[model samples]
Target: MNRSSYPYVKTPPIFRCLIKKQQQATEELTYKPRRRRRRKVNNSDFYWWGFPIGTGGYVIIRFLLTIDWDFGSFIIFMGAVAIALISGYLLIRSYYRDFKSEPPPEYIVNKEIRKKAIDAKNKIRKRYLSRPLKDKVKKLLKGKVRTLEPLTPSATVGVSEKQFLAVLQKYFGQRVNFPNGVFSIIGTTFEYTPDIVYQDSYTGLTIDIEIDEPYAGKSKEPHHCNDNDKDRNRDDFFLKRNWVVVRFAEEQVVKYPVACAYYLSKVIYQLSGIRYEVPAEKLPSIPTWDSEESTSMARLLHRETYLKEHGLWQIRIS
Candidate 1:
């Protein structure tokens, strides 16, 4: 058959050669080994350098020392090294002893510094003390004083509470019963006692004072219910007997003592028809908490109960 007459044609030599080359390349790739990744050396291995150097150095020194015939120059060198090591060790030991035996540098310096500091403080104190009597009185009486006292159930009344009672005695003067000459409220019936009580000689007015601390935000339901309930029961008893109650928080005594005192003074005046003005500058601003009014009422009721129960209302204070 004539090739020209057929539609299909034979492949060219170049095309055949290309096909063979492609097959050979694919076969070569299939048999090739995979490349492995190398692991990195860690920097922490640097610490091992000390062990090798120390062991090798010790071994070399021991070997040299064991030689039967030592060169004179080598002996001199070894002796010098030995003397140097011994001297270094002694110096280190002496430094340690000095550090351990002597007082620290800070302590020595602080002692000297404290002496000068005390001298300066004394001079300032003397200057204030040398001021006029009226000025001195004002300073002593000025800002609210807070006596830091523990609030443990068994702890005694604090210095500030004592001072507050003293102030009340000074102002009221013979109008209240204070068996020890210092105003104090006492009752034999209850395990706990009120802080102070006062009775008017003419009108039969009774007033009770309680110095309280911050509420500390104890919840009313369970934690503080016992103390609160006791107060309520006491107040109710006083109300039944027609006595006035007054309560003062510790913050009121410390931050706004004059205001607290003024309010008490007002209550006294209303009861006894006696009048006094509380210095406006010293009065503390009224507290903004929701419990202030309730606290005031509770204090009044508690005081009334103690006075009525103890027969203090019968005391005539003219």
Candidate 2:
């Protein structure tokens, strides 16, 4: 039986399916343009285009001043320049339109495409919400703690708890307090030692301030994950009792002592309706501490020694 004699040779079902898929893939590859997802235009786009345009203006001005040419030649040159500028402007406008235009309904209605749109919107929202917190964190890290101290009002200040609280007291007097008390969380009692507590003498408003260090307990052990849970519980207890809660990292206290003082002073004045001032003559001598470096290192040692030698370092936070 010759193969040619069999007018219809049956192909296997699996092979037929594979051939169909291959043809479909080939058609998709050939017919579709390999276009990338268009990105949103930003202010940088204007700056990027503006620089060249600005430079070209100067070049044209210089050309006009230096060129020894007839009026006819100048007119022709100007005409060409005008045409080029117009074309460039139109090209940029078209590019912007192409990018900003919405995709076709079929493309937009696709489940994957819709999901991407949702995700992109959520991502932007998250970033916008987190911006302030991130900026504060950056300020803390940059050592521009915005201290209230006149010496370096725009910079970070001290490097120790003693120094931090000293600056606070130096200005606010007896308003600053440290209290160890008991509080309830979820019907359970926990001993809470607030780093600093301020009670407004006039208004009787209370504020609980916590300065967290990397270590825990009198033994100075490293903080475990569960430590945060305990801290949160303590904070909740204060909030339940109608006390205003404020938390600062130890680094923030040390690095931005003056800023911390200013911040606390502002809170106190707002709470008590009483304004306090640091004596101009009593202000401590400020050492040349660079904002670019951490005071916790050798820089801290030097500061401590200097303060000690000058009888300026207070051993007690009070």
- Note the residue pairs that clash in candidate 1: 201-317, 245-300, 246-300
lDDT of 1 at 258: 56
lDDT of 1 by residue, 155-195 (tens): 24532455566666666666643222231124642333345
Q: List the residue pairs that clash in candidate 2.
A: 147-258, 147-259, 148-258
True-vs-predicted CA distance for residue 149, candidate 1, Å: 28
Alpha-carbon TM-score of each model against the true structure: 0.33, 0.34
Local accuracy of candidate 2 as per-residue lDDT tens digits, 3-94: 22111112223223433533343331112333646556677775766666666676567667765887876775686577559656964885
Q: Report, for all candidates in order, the number of backbone clashes.
A: 3, 3
